[model samples]
Target: MTRLVVVGAGLMGEAIFSGLLASGWAPADIVVSDARAERRAELSERYGVGSGEAVDAVADAQTVLLAVKPADVGGVLEEIGDRLAPDALLLSVCAGVALATLQAGVREGTPVVRAMPNTPARVGEAITAVSPGTHATDDHLAEVTEILGAVGRVITVAEKYQDSVTAVSGSGPAYVFLVAEAMIEGGVHVGLPRDVATELAVQTLFGSATLLRDTGDHPAILRENVTSPGGTTAAALRRLEDHGVRAAFLAAVEAARDRSLELG
Candidate 1:
């Protein structure tokens, strides 16, 4: 029997599989399932893992990762619930699906964990937030943390706070990409070549993030450190503030959080 069964072959699923392999999991120890035969074939060919029907892939597995779309999760659980080993952990990355909904579809007392991971998982730098269901134990959460830690950082949060976590980190990558896009365009507007602008914008974002992570300093302090009185940085920041960029971000995150709640 496989040690882990991934029930979807989408980008996040592929990222998790890649991360696990990078973390030294043998391909033979993992199995994958997808609705499309072509996707199954692709994953098997690319990762050298076994591929089959969801029920077949999950049978006797130690852990079952439900990486399917939220709309499809119910059907997946209904199909595999009985087949899952009694002690197997059910770790889900289906956005907007609640633990109660997942538990409703599975066998009684089956441990369930819900995770919200961003696109950065593709690059092995994601920050995933995990929450436990009614039956999930501390050990189950730790197991999930270890599994997701293969991709990046993992933090435990109460189920009630998951929607907020989803809005901030789950949809956070697009916000960063939007900022990078604007910065690149701003450089182009200042007469820099597109390629040069892209490199400068991308590297600046990367370096700034690295500095913030490594220094443990407040972001305001970092901003102040870079902004000399009446300097270019100050001028640019003033324009952003004048345009209510911060307020816009606040509203955007609230909107995202509201939508996540609606989806659940």
Candidate 2:
């Protein structure tokens, strides 16, 4: 049976498909369709999955995963939405697209799910938030969860909260990268070689994130544990505070959230 049809072969689309294969999904059960013949051919050759046009790919497919660009979503939806099996699931990861839009594009009673997943999905550490549409049932949501789990953690939230989720986890990696860049530059300023500074910054970030996840301690608590009353860490922390780092992050997230709202 052609169980899943992926409707894009872009970066995030490729990531999800690759993750599914890595997690043991059979190639024969998956088919990918892309408007670009080159993309379709490349993925078919690389992953050994069936490739075809969007409408043909979704035919009899139990689930359709839409990973197209925000602007291209409507065209793809129009091409395949009505063709989807009534009981099939339509899971989308297009940022700024809404459940209402997805539902309107699809056949009546087709279950739709809108998800916001970050670029980290390329590395299998993504945190995705999924919102169910009006026709989606618990089983449909579970199916979406199971598919996304091939990449990383999944959370379910109300549709109303998706913009906030996009601001946080969806665009969160860029914020972390910006911090890493600054940290590396700081290290270089203090006389470390650029390569050495990059390694140090990357490892520190990886270790700190691991610590945070493993310990589940409040970030403030963890920072306090590192900062002795008036030590070097405290001095650095004070400098960062004085420089408005915290406020900048707050403003950045707000801006991202507002942009997402505008896009919707």
Q: How accurate is candidate 1 locally (lDDT)?
A: 0.92
Question: Compared with the true structure, what per-residue lDDT tens digits does model 1 show for residues 56-147?
Answer: 77877888999999888888888988888888889999999999998887888899999999889999999999999988899998889888
**Per-candidate clash tally:** 0, 0
Q: Each model's TM-score, in the order given?
A: 0.98, 0.98
RMSD of each: 0.9, 0.9
Give the Å error, residue 198, model 2: 0.9
lDDT of candidate 2?
Answer: 0.92
Model-by-model lDDT, in order?
0.92, 0.92
Residue pairs in clash, model 2: none
Task: Tell how far residue 129 is off in model 2, in angstroms.
Answer: 0.6
Q: Report the lDDT of model 1 for residue 51.
A: 88
